[model samples]
Target: MIKFNQLRKVFDDGTVALDGVTIKVEQGEFVVVLGPSGSGKTTLLRSVNGLVSPTSGNVRVNDVEVCEQSLRMVRRKVGMIFQQFNLVGNLSVINNVLTGSFSTYNKWYSNLYIFSKELRIRALAVLDRVGLLDKAYQRTDELSGGQQQRVGIARALMQQPDVLLADEPIASLDPMIAYNILSLLREISAEDKITVLCSLHQVDFAMHFAQRIVGLSEGKVVMDEPQKDLTAEYIRKIYKTHDKGLFFGPESKPYSDDQLVTWSEYK
Candidate 1:
């Protein structure tokens, strides 16, 4: 569903955020990008949706090349979740979700808060899916961190997108809440048949939820393999060598190859 071919991104200051990165994700697949800060994870995700124009090479989604003219269509098929839960704090939860329909709404009508009854109904259903229908009338800032993130997820679902891009969606929450969010994302991906490409700092969460893991280091892909092939020792090595232990928490420990198990086996 998504393809990046020899993609490169260099800022005006000569910072190389992505260096000849290439990867592909099929429809209905859940892939996790594992990387530390400054490893091009965000850049890679942004490029897919045209938020960041590539300095070189191409990005294609669902067989369409991502460019200036195609961005509108591309974005309509893509939904993004931010780490900061990028919502208008004072807006009601329903209103926040309705913003996802901006691409489909008339500009004048959208500016006037004139959403159609159909949109409102759909928004409510999305909230219900995220277990937040009761909170629809509440202001976003009034919700808890996990709830707010759920609101974010519901907002993304408002697009009814075929692909979801989550950039460290659980970074601000507690470990348990983080697990809940990831689990919810996994369930949603399966139920909706939406392709998910999420970036994560935690190796354990990636292993638990992702069918495939792509490890990045120094703005390039260092490893891309199925979860079944991953070893705890290899994961530790990826973080230590690329991120200098920034992503590896205190509880991290290397497991022998014999202890490694595929996600399906774990289940």
Candidate 2:
């Protein structure tokens, strides 16, 4: 449902975020982009909904090109979750979710932040889907970190998007909270048939939830394979370091709680 062709991005400072990166994802597939910091994961995700304009090459969603002319349509088809939650902290949880439906508003009514009854009902349903129905009337800032991220997810689902792009959505949360968020995302991808492209540095979460894993290093795709086929050597290459002592060899056992704790440092 998504395609990236020879995409390259060079910022004003001459830092290349993506270099000749090409990847394709099928509808309803849950894919994870695994890379250390500065590996272009964020840039790659942003390119999908026109948040980041590529210097060259192209990005297409559901056969529609993502560009200035088609940006509105592409954005309507895409939903984004941010690392920072990106909600209006003072707004009630339901109101925050209602913001996602703004794209569907008419030009005359878009500025009022006034939503239709149908939209409000839909928003309530989305909040319930994220397990926050009881907190819909509560202030967003008063919610816990994981609950706030759930609010973000509810907001994204308000778009009824065909594709969901989560840019390090769990980076700031504790390990258990992060697992809950990932589990919720996986459930949404499976039950809702929404294509999910989540960028993460955590290997265990990706392995547990993703059907496909795409690894990036520097600004290029270093490895793209099914989660079951990914190897420890390729993972090490993706991080570009051995000092973490993350893996011993191809035959190495699964990471223990201590190793998982060490892996958390990458975030």
TM-score of each: 0.92, 0.91
Flag clash pairs in model 2: none
| Candidate whose TM-score is highest | 1
What would the per-residue lDDT of candidate 1 be over residues 181-245, giving only the tens digit for each residue?
99999999999999999999777788888989988877888888997666655565556543323
Score candidate 2 by TM-score against the native.
Answer: 0.91
Residue pairs clashing, model 1: none
Over 4 Å off in model 2, which ranges? 107-110, 247-267
lDDT of each: 0.88, 0.89
Worst 10 residues of 1 by lDDT: 242-251
**Tens digit per residue, CA lDDT, model 2, 142-193:** 9999999999999999989999999999999997999899999999999999
lDDT of 1 at 41: 92
